[model samples]
Target: MASNGSDPHGPDRPVVGLTTYGERAAYGVWDHDTVLLPSTYPDIVFAAGGIPVLLPPRPQAAAAVDRIDALVLSGGPDIDPQRYGADRHPLTGAARAERDAAEIAMLQRALEREIPVLGVCRGLQMLNVALGGTLVQHLPDAVGHNGHNPTPGKFATTMVDLVPGGRVATAVGTTVAVQCHHHQALDRLADGLVVTARAGDGTVEAVELDERPFVVGVQWHPEQDATDIRLMAALLAATRT
Candidate 1:
């Protein structure tokens, strides 16, 4: 029988380590540099019957894989283009070098250990770049519009078509409406990643490394929609094995 995760005597839940943002933040009268992440990320994880652990960017963040059952590369700032051998685009936002280095190390370590991983938004981009993939840098320039990020500080609605029999399809079916807020997307796909989903505008919406038990990256913010948790739930399920 599966434990409900609420009872102390029940089987222990999987520990999910989520990467966070290293930025200057304000809370009350204190305005200083801090490690932060949206509560929605952890909220959805806990709802899916997993223990959530925040992983801040640090020199040795990759060591965290030794203590976690799964990893989530949460959404945040743009990755430095130089990491992938590209010149910065005029429209590209400033990169968080430290965060990029730390997350990449953590991701590589997680992959080496075959730890289940789920990437969201910028997290998706990181997965691609870390695996020798490249990003469009500016979707508006490539797609000729900003529909993927129609508004600032708000999510745009996007309908994605999932490839049949893929991990994403098994979790969320063939078609799904997702919340999107990204200005960049996957360009030259990595060597082993399979395209699992795409937007109506022909944007790459998701990718996965089929060789691994679970390594999925979605260009949408699944955590934003509190009502739906299929993605996070699927990630937690992988941790059990």
Candidate 2:
């Protein structure tokens, strides 16, 4: 539903707007149209005590921000190649230019209003690009890792080390293993953003905006990983403030 420039619920529940994937027509409808986010997303949000709202790609994003308290850019296909000034890799997936614009608008609004945000996987990349950051188009090919982004249908476990006293370490309370499935990663950490975690091989794994109340992003899929519960908890805490 499009917004009419008003807070729909008047600051009660902390509403988190998550970006959705785009789909091209397949037969009558695109397969991505019906693509569902892992149930873990809402489960984890609710577990962390926040309301989850899907943020569809819309041109009227300024109006949408009025109704949300926070934002969570969910994982999906690769971000648009033009965003970071690169050619599309053969493996890049569907790019929703509308979704990219909407999410960035949401991110900007959240920051201006000081709303907490938690970006996961593709969401993380979105946050980086939105903040003038660049991305490594293909991690394994560029950085020599097995597969930073695993096949979309399956899950893989990998280790992520956190810099001592970094946001992710302070939140997770440990430099431990996590589940990763991205083939791309942050090549240049956004200005004012700090690298909080990384793969043992030096692939950037997580980043957080120091000035924002709770703008944290992780390359790994935290919603699917048991070790990253602190990210949700930290974001929820920011909503209360």
Candidate 3:
């Protein structure tokens, strides 16, 4: 690990690069520079003993991977269904084509290199689609129940049951509450990834790769409630290894 900066945790801190969506500034209708993530994501990671590196949207995502130890794909807008062979839903939010392409490229590169990756919410969906998987697009429609109701916006809470003997169970030692704010979820898992958790409605809440190197996805947003500290800790631990 690079000791370019002192570790706040008093050890070799892992460098985890977190990807975020670009938000256009709304100032007098004048276009401003692209803004980074909302900051809660990295704050959680930092509190969990890892250094957070923000990766901006880029076309040369392959080259960007060399700069970090591991990758954390953060939550954002609904992914374009076309990328995963589905028609657009009437409620589908904004879709950034460039970001979609870049993130897909980055995910492919990471898996090819066997690098650790953690995906949350939309990030989870991206991982699934990149690995020959499909998504529900709207949880209410697919799950046949309101999976996102408990948490309608950011900074809310939800429940998840950990799959026994799964990666999340091993990390957290128990199924617990996590924060969520997404309307979409995994319909069919990506290749080589196993479902590790679920909601009461039986919505897929988490998944982990059967192979080596920490690659997992969660439907909840741990960055919001900070209840599932293990989520961030696990990512940091993967980055160090």
Q: Clash number for every model?
A: 0, 5, 0
| Shift of residue 205 alpha carbon in model 1, Å | 0.3
Alpha-carbon RMSD of each model: 2.5, 5.0, 2.8
lDDT scores of the candidates, listed in order: 0.89, 0.75, 0.78
Q: Rank the candidates by lDDT, best first.
A: 1, 3, 2
lDDT of 2 by residue, 1-241 (tens): 2222333333354676766655543555434354345678877776665678776677575467778777888887778989878888887777878878877888888788777788898888988998899888878877775665557677678788888876678888556778888788898877988888878788888888987667889887778854456778777666666
Alpha carbon deviation, residue 41, candidate 2 (Å): 1.1
lDDT of 1 by residue, 5-43 (tens): 544224687889999999898999999999999999889
Which lDDT tens digits does candidate 3 get at residues 1-241? 5343445385667777788777877668688768479778888877887778887777575567776777888888888899889988898877888778878878777777777888888888888898889988777787676647545563555678997777777787556877678788888777798988888778888888887668988887778755556768876666555
Q: What is the lDDT for 111 in model 2? A: 82
Best by TM-score: 1
Window of ten residues with lowest summed lDDT in model 1: 1-10
Pick the lDDT winner. Answer: 1
Residue 52 Cα positional deviation in candidate 1, in Å, after optimal superposition? 0.4
Residue 148 of model 3, lDDT score: 74
